[model samples]
Target chain A: MASDDSVSLRVTPLFSLCQELGARFTPFAGYRMALSFPAGTLREHQHTREAASLFDVSHMGQIVVSGPDRVALLESLTPASIRALPPGRLRYSMFTTPTGGVLDDLMIACRGDDLMVVVNAARREADLAHLREAARGHAADVALLEDQALLALQGPAAAAVLSALAAGVGDLPFLGMGPFALDGVLCWVSRSGYTGEDGFEISVKATHVEPLARRLLADPRVAPAGLAARDTLRLEAGLCLNGADLTPSITPVEAGLGWVVGRERRLDGQFPGSDVLFQQLAEGPAWCRVGLRLAGRAVARPGAPVLDPQGAEVGVVTSGGFSPTLNQPIAMARVPAALASPGQPLAVRVRDHQLDALVTALPFVPARTVGRACSGPSEPRNKP
Target chain B: MSKVYYTEDHEWIRVEDGKEGTVGITDFAQAQMGDVVFVELPPVGTVLTQGEQAAVVESVKAASELYAPVSGTVVAVNPDLPDAPGTVNEDPQGEGWFFRLALTQPNELADLMDQDAYEVFVAEAGESAG
Candidate 1:
């Protein structure tokens, strides 16, 4: 929806390479994304669990914030404690509205004198405008890295594959970022990713991405993965997608992302929606996000009505699909806080029938991310 | 061997005798559907009308409805499908058959496309869709 109806969709830096791999392209967030490959999204998903899978995340927006007042200006816009962020570490945070609604979720990395912010592709245009406008007369400068491409190499074998191409890449701590040379090409690599795996998000120039991607793909343990597999992998790890789960009406507390709000900023939080978010955190939100395990094979899609045991509509599903890892139907829903528990009985209305659903603990698959080592797409390391 | 008839929705029916037919999704449909995860089939002896929804084939990404190609009574369903639907991706036209029909309106077969016409139909539809 970001692009005008008459405008043509843009392709990523790896578009031609994806095509060479027999990728089926689909329009995604104004970009021509590779939805799946010849092996299919499901097959790519299972392969990532056992080996490494490279995902072209060039659609994501990367912004560089530099200046003495950058941290102050940014902290004033969100609940993150930017002042406490040490250099070379990544922090997951969100941009919120005055009424506690989420605008978008993002990853903020402290890169010495500057900060690097990666936001969702669908919200990039808005995020850029918001950042530029917010900086205004402040000493902070916001600039989009237009020539850069972001690629995520994820899975259990991700570290080994990357380490083979770049020595010492495996030693970077989880959520840490620094300069690394992949086959002698300097790139900023971070030990972070959306898939709950021990992986790296490599930020390289657009010209270098294709060759780097090809280099990784050349590994027997690494293969090209597409957006479809990325979605399923994140869902199985209980990670929320931007448009489906997080929205302008959903608060961090209600979305089970209270930790994303800096704990140190609680009493003195000054960002938009701080009061509302802190109040909900204290009293607990009336509605809370939860994971659902469907009884039958039928997938419970997003927007399906969640019903209570007495057959009354209690909540709504925000994200749902057939989890390839679990080989069963799974979903995420916003239900009453009282019903947000492990093993709580619930039902989802799919088409005409009500399928029995149970409230399961999130991260249907266990997270394998490195603390100082490696991991998978995740449930925010809550250790569920 | 029986002459096979195809539907726009991607179902196929092979009729050996005028009244008896085996129904399943076409190979083109299976390839497009991706990895089959689970399947839901109507019970044996269920009566179906032409174009009526008779079965559901769920893939990792979505669920697709398999419609009855011609009005008939479902005398049998592939017993192995519900437990191992991935067979649909492997042998969609053969071992992956969904149901057998005792046709009530065998005349409905004339309205569907044959192999040659269906190939052209699929080709044009795919071109327009892509």
Candidate 2:
């Protein structure tokens, strides 16, 4: 099943840094990303849990939309309420197809006059096209800033480690964005990350990426994390990966992202697939994504068949793995709406093995951020 | 001396004590897989059919299926190897042995390639990669 083609993609500026750390590099999203360091994936995963880990996510797209009509122009393309977002706040939004299917999920942060967007590295081209097409009739402008490198310094001690590199970072609340100086380099910093931990996503110029990464890694708490831990971490956090858990055919509503579509946007009914999403919201989706904890040690991997009490095929596992955090097998499945309820028992057949499983609330790990409580924007939360 | 045999799938088996056999992935196979992280061992006493996947080995690169070289009942599995998956890289033949099987038919070893032929196969694979 392996390909014979020898096609090496462009390496990031931190390629040598990863190698110096003895990172096991693997091809991902057209970039050679570290799968784990010399400590191995298990330790790398554990290290991130205990302290901090530096991730080179520079391959992710970082774009800026400026001009007077930036907020309005951006709101037309995404389902989130960008116009309502106060300056220095970030919102999770997804680009949708004409029919309202999600093209990609991204983070949009408002930086005063300009809007900073971070997108999945794999969907850079399609997301850019969607932005360009939406910008055609708008009053604002779009600029894809290829020069910015995205770096995620994540874990419990992440704030303490990053505070040393960048000043005034300690004051920034979760999901809040502001400009900061790292090594005298002015970069857009957002208090957000993929790992279900409190962290920061710093957008710096590509040239300054390596130096900042090194400075951050110099702290004893931070180890170089690769895609393997990243995947496991995100999965434990109950986050859905783009190609695996979502695609253009899956709408945001069906993907459990109805909250992103602001109340105003939902009422306006101008966004793509608004009618279908609204209807689905009124009457639950035919199939909803649910989390499953395998009854036994058997893993229910993606494409594995799900059976009912009578052994009839009911659904398929969209994403499944051994959750290092939970110390057991877990999975996400697109099952019939009736079985989507939490605490329901189900069976997953893997190679003639019918393993018992139970539906549970997503985010095997509860979000540790200061979010979920504050209905309002991230700002105005003063630190003690 | 215990005789060693190899399968085309890059697995090596060493028959010992007449009917008992120790199975492991070859060194060449481990090198091709890069860094080994997790080794899924078969349950002790589970009967495995020849050429069927009896266990799994997951490296940092990808997860691979380890085929049973000879049909037999699993007798013992190396429990230490899971916590120290790097044993597969450190000693692919000794401590990294996946499991021991009580062979149902010792004659199946005749179907596998001998050490010399296995070396030739590994050499050819290296040449193909080059």
B1-130, model 1: which lDDT tens digit per residue? 6899999899999998797999999988887778888888899999999999999888876788999999999999999998788899999999999999999999999999999999998888666545
Candidate 2 regions with alpha-carbon error over 4 angstroms: A1-6, A371-384, B3-10, B17-19, B26-51, B58-62, B70-96, B102-130
Question: For residues A1-384, what per-residue lDDT tens digits would candidate 2 score against the true structure?
Answer: 232222566677788888888775667888877767767665677788789888889888888888887877777777778878889998888887666678888888888879988889899887888888878888777788867788988888988888887768977878888889988899888888887788888888889999899888888888888888888787777787887777777776676766767777877867777777778777767777778898655556788888777788898888887777786778888788788878888899876678888888887876666554242222221110
Question: Mind giving the per-residue lDDT tens digits that candidate 1 earns over A251-358?
Answer: 878888887777678868888999998888888888888999999788888899999999999999999988988888999998998999888999999878899999
Q: In model 1 chain B, which range of ten residues has the least summed lDDT?
A: B121-130
Best candidate according to DockQ: 1
Runs in model 1 deviating more than 4 A are A1-7, A372-384
Docking class of 2: acceptable
Model 1 TM-score, all chains together: 0.94
Global lDDT of each candidate: 0.88, 0.79
DockQ of each: 0.40, 0.26
True contacts kept of each: 0.41, 0.06
